[model samples]
Structure formats: C-alpha cells, structure tokens
Target: MPVTTQSWVVTQRLPDLLFAADARDEPISLTAADYRALHWAWSEAIGDYTRRTVTKPGDKLVAFAAIAELFQRTWRAEYLAGLWRPTLLQDLLWATNYEGRAPRPERYRAPSWSWAAVDGHVVASLLDDWLGAGVGTAVQRCEVLECEVVPATPLLPLGKVLSGTLRLRAAMVKATWDPDAQLPVLYAALDRLEEATLTSPPATSPAPELTQIGCAYPDSTEDACEIWAVPVLWNKAEKYAAGLVITPAATEGVYRRVGCFHSPEPDEDPGRLVWMLEQKKQEIIII
Candidate 1:
C-alpha cells in the first residue's frame, strides 16, 4: 500500500492541521519549497472529500466539495508550481478589493480583510483571485463546475458569500433534462452527512433546481461534446497542463489523450515532490 503523504504545503490543512496552524496569529512564513509541499497536501485532502458529490441550486445546500475542489485547483495548484507569490497575490488583492480606492484609499476607507459575512470562504476567494488569470491554456478545467466562477458580479466579495442558511438539510438535488420524459441528467447528490447520521441515507429526497455558476466550464455544444466530458471525469484533473484532461468515453477503442502528467508513482524512498512530476513525466504511462 502506498502511504499518502501531503505533497502540498498550502493545500494540506487536514482537519487537525488547521487547528495547529491557526494557533499562531502571525503568518508562518515558509520558503517557496515548503509552500509547494503544502499545496500538494491540500489538493490531496480537498480531492478526497469533495470528489464525490454534485450540487445544484435550491437543492438545499450547495456542494461544498465543488467549492473546495475549485480552491485547490486554483491557487493551491499554482502556488505549488511556485508561479504565484507576494507579487501575484498583491496584484489580485489590489484588482479585486483596492481598485477604485484611489488617492491613498487606505486613508479614506477599505473593505474588511474578511470579505465574507456568513460563510468563512476567505480561502475560496483568495484562491480565485490568485488562480483566475490569463487566456487560452490559462482557463480553468475541471468537472462538476459546468460554469465559471465570475469574480465581478456578486453583490458581496467572494470572501463573504453565503449559501442562504445552514439550517437547511444539506444535499444535492436531482437534475432533469426533459421534464415530461423524466430523463435523468445526473446531479450526483451526495450529502455531507453528520457523523451521527451516516448510518441512514437522507430522510428527504433531493429536489434540485437549475442555476448556473460562473466559474465552472459550460457544457460543450460541439460535435465532440462527449469528448469534453472525459476531462471532467478524470480523477486527477489538475495534473494536466491545460488544466484539462483530454479523453473521451469509448466502448472498446483506444484513445490518445493530450495532457502533461506529473509522476504518478514516486520512489519508495523519502524525497522531495516538487520535481516529482517533471522528473517522472515520461515514467508515467496512460492506459
């Protein structure tokens, strides 16, 4: 059995890790290398929890897994690559929060450090600002997102958005394509049940509504629509360079998927994971 180690420094805050780290008030400065380790750890942890469910609007509760996955793919991935830092963060913070506050905006006023009101989604918003940049290859690619997380339109900043209420039963509602036909369009509703209630399935069935989120990718309207679905299903999506996994569902045919992969299997020996992908890219073979 392979021992799952936290390869990401930024993303690796397990339930317990957060508590320990939060003990310190000041930022615990880490080197670039340390940050990458945290990023890998965080990605693995986030993927472990949020990979299972799909959520829709008016369904009850939003799919936190979807949001968590977005965060890891966004800032955590780039931070791991060592591409973003104080400079990148500075730019993002300025554009998103301090843009119009001209002429020593600091003197006049400023937005709260915590932009969120109800949900403590500061982590999510920070990830968005840092990761959401560029065009072409820079576009984010992941499944479940069916839309993109647009930064500008919301009334409150991302750091301070809410899912209405926490009292509502948590779950993903079903999605129907043709209402009369009652065709199942797949809304993979998995509840993040409480530890005490895992023994039983949800009491009320899911009744999801159709609403679009801006950050996720839109469904393909091309001849190769099914081909696009492949990228969404691939478990390890962030591994791809285009932020997309190029594959298609086939009955019994082999396909060549376009992608850049990191090392799938590391040496048994304990070593750094930063170069693991680059050094072991060729060693990884796609079935």
Candidate 2:
C-alpha cells in the first residue's frame, strides 16, 4: 500500500470568501468588479435558499429574514420582499427554474415579481456582471415610478409580505402563444416595424426573418395565455436584453409578473427585442 499521509486542514477561506467583500461597520464601497462579486454571493444565497424544501411553504420569506436583516445593516437599503431597492431593476430579473420543482403554493405569499411567490429554484440575472465587465452600456427601459410592500406582521417587517406592487413606466407589447413550443411569440410586434417602414422608408428594404424573437420562461405555462413582454434593460452595443413577462390582473390597468426573459441566447436575435422596445411606452402597475 502507498504511504498515506494523515493531516488536518482548516479552510479559513471557506466563509471569508463569501462575506469578505461585504461591508460590516460601514456600507460597502468597492470597485465595480468587487461590488459585483458581493452581489453574486448574496444572489447565490437567495438562489440556494429558495430551492430548499420547507415544512411550511408560507415561511419562505420568514426563513430568510435573519439573513436579510443582517444584510440590511450593511446594505442600508429598503428590502422589497426578496429584493433590494438599490438594485431593484436588476433584482427584478430573476426567473423560475422549473426543473424538478413543485407547483406554487395555493396560499398567498409574495407578489409575482418576487422569488418568494414561486416554489422552485430561481436564478438572478447576470446583467450586473455583464455591465461591470464593460461588455456593453445598459439603457434602462423601465422607469420604476413607485414600489411598495406591505408586511403581514408590522413588527416583523422582513418576515412575511402581505401584498406588494410596483408602479412602472415601460415599453409593453402583447405576445401570442406558440402552441408547439409552449412559449410566447412576438408576431404582433412585426406590425410596428411595417408601420414604421411605411412612414419612413430606409435606404434598403428591411425584411426581418424572425418567427420567435426570444425565450419567455413563464412561471405557469397553463396560465401564460394573453401575456405581454416588458423589456427593462437594453444593451444596444452588445445586442442583449432582459425584461419581465406579465399578464393582466383583475384590475383594468394592473399586471402581474409571470416570468422574465433575456435575449441573445443561442439563436435568438436581440434586434427583435430592440424593435419591441420601439413600439410604445406606457405607465402600468404590477402586483
């Protein structure tokens, strides 16, 4: 038998790597790259915690309250359910990962835009990383006019949410369902392009051969009918985008987030998303 060495090792870098960049006494102030690493650590924790199977499904936000409280001291920012206010736009970019996931709870939890609203693994968008890397400059498409979250227990504000809503002004476009792929299609958006072409003809006739612009990862495929695509951030230089997929709520002008979608994935074209953004801008509420 080969000589075996008996040794004990202490991995000091284990937890340090996670919280080293985070601020303790003072708020975190670092270079763009370092700040992004800090955000990644927090996002990873949220992603892992959301995937866990719990005895009380309603305790989703409650379970993570301590962690949120801890970060609150350092972040010094308002906590909007599962997301933070400072980076709310990027935080809105989370999407449900339905692989081996259970159905959402019947009881009310958080709003549809929040990760706590769903029961499954979720991934936060990499838009911050992409921006920090200087890949492209981001032009915010959605203006977060107002946001509010009501807590179940006034004493434990961060524990459980009663109701939440976001008032926004963004470009909203209707999408049709694709029965074959079980996804939403932007067939109507092309009409805008035709209208623009007719009004102001370009030097060359622009014929866009696009059937499906980008992917729409809906929270519930069964209830994703009559959906709309709302592009939040558009990186024109790099040709990439990210936005929310929403459906109309019971209220006349109110909508609810069903899921989120990003562009330039595989064969998808970002130009189509750019076209979608040019359609029209409207002020709407999401709850």
Candidate 3:
C-alpha cells in the first residue's frame, strides 16, 4: 500500500480574490452606496435575529443600541437615535402576521399592547411622521414600577425581560367586537348637539353617519364582550386616535391589553364620550 500522508489541509480565499478592488483609488469618505450596504446588512440581521428572540417593550431601546453598535462605522449616533420612535411604533402595530390567530405566550413577557410580545416582522408606513408632527398626546402620564432584563451573552443577543409594571393615565369605555367586520363596534346614537359640535355645516344634511372606526386585537381569540377601549392618539391634527383595547386578567383589578381601535375622527373628548355612552371612567390602569 502506498504510504498515506499524515495530514493534509487546504484553504482558499476565492471571494476576496474575485472581488478585490484597488484600495488606492477607493473613496476616502463613506458614500451613499456604503450607507445603503450597511443598512441592508443591519436590516437583514435584525429580521433574522428578532424572529428567534423574545423581546419586551421595555427592552426596545437596548435592543436598538446593540444593533447600532454592529454598524457604528457606517452611521452616526444622532441618526441612529432618531430611528427609535418609529421603530417602536412599527413594531407595536405590525409585529405579527395573522395577529388574531397567533397564540398567546403562557409566560408573560411584555404587555399585550406592546409589539415586543409578538413574533414576526414589523412593518410601518414610510410616510409616518414619528417626531410627533401630527401626533396627539392622549396619554397624560406613565409610571413604571419594575423592569428587568436577563444578562445578555454571546449566544443570546436579546436578553429576556423578567417582569415589568406600567401605569397609565387613560380613559376607557365599554365596547364589543363585531366578528363579521373583524372590528370592535362602539354604538352611540349621535346626539344632534354633539354632531353639530364635532362636524362642519353638514347640519342641513343627514346627521353625521354613526361614527364608525376600525379596531384590531393584539390576540384575536380574546372573547370578552365587556372590553374597555382606552384613548391613545396616533395623530392630533388629523383627528386620529387609537384605543388600547383591554380585558380583565387572571389577577383581579389588573387589566391586560388585547387590541386597539383606530378612530379617524376622535373630535370628541374621550372621557366625555365615555360618559355619553353611559360607561364608567377608568382613570388609572396598571399592567
């Protein structure tokens, strides 16, 4: 038998050799092309990693910082910071596909209202002005009682949040879901005076059509008819508002978010509207 070689190893850098460029002629400053490449890489990484990570609302900022660090050479600190708000909002609204059909996690991570609780890619409107341009301030205040995250390691890019508490100064009203329409319906016979106050001189015409709004649930299987809708503004100038849909949790007096109601014309004060609808006011909520 021919003598076998004790050991043999080979390695090749074909990609580097094939794609090598003249370093002397390379541009000194980063260009738009460089930025685009960096952004694409970062986005791809986030899309893949977030799908497998268990995220929480309170951990959003920290997660963003970690991702930014990976691309620091290509982006400025201020530019990265500016991306936070919109990213948070986008994650909250469209984090999961078939949201209604998604199963609820047995162990609590983030409140149902937060996008971080869901699993999937988050999408947002490109034209949305996240700097509070058309946004309204419906939430008067927020208090955090506790927020903790697991220590991150090389294997876990996103640390799991242990537990959290959040208190909100909001207004809530009773409502029910219309399965046929896949939206929560709030029926309030529009009072002539209220209609006149909210709308322009269409007084001569039919009373403003029953104020119908689009509503969505964080978990579609929620079957509580005695649901509460809390007013949260998405846009003030445009008279848009989103109602944080809530239901009673296992712990009495503690409410959990289930969905949201989008009102294109929330011209009326939410508190007053609740009163008009003959529903009790829920001033402070803890979750």
TM value for model 3 = 0.49
Better of 1 and 3 by TM-score: 3
**Please, what's the RMSD in Å of model 1?**
22.1
| Location of the lowest summed lDDT over 10 successive residues in candidate 3 | 2-11
lDDT winner between candidates 2 and 3: 2
Ranking 1 against 3 by lDDT, winner = 3
Q: Rank the candidates by lDDT, best first.
A: 2, 3, 1
Please, what are the lDDT tens digits per residue for candidate 2 over residues 1-287? Answer: 11111210111212343344343545566566654665676687777766667677788888777666655654567999999987888888886665644465678899989888887777765464444335534554578999999999987888799899998888887665452343444443354345345667766656644445566666654455677878877766556667887889899989998777666453445354555656678897999
The estimated TM-scores of all candidates read 0.25, 0.79, 0.49
Best of the candidates, TM-score: 2
Compared with the true structure, what per-residue lDDT tens digits does model 1 show for residues 219-256? 11112222211211111223222112123324233221
Candidate scoring better on TM-score of 1 and 2: 2
lDDT of 3 at 161: 40
Weakest 10 consecutive residues of candidate 1 by summed lDDT: 163-172
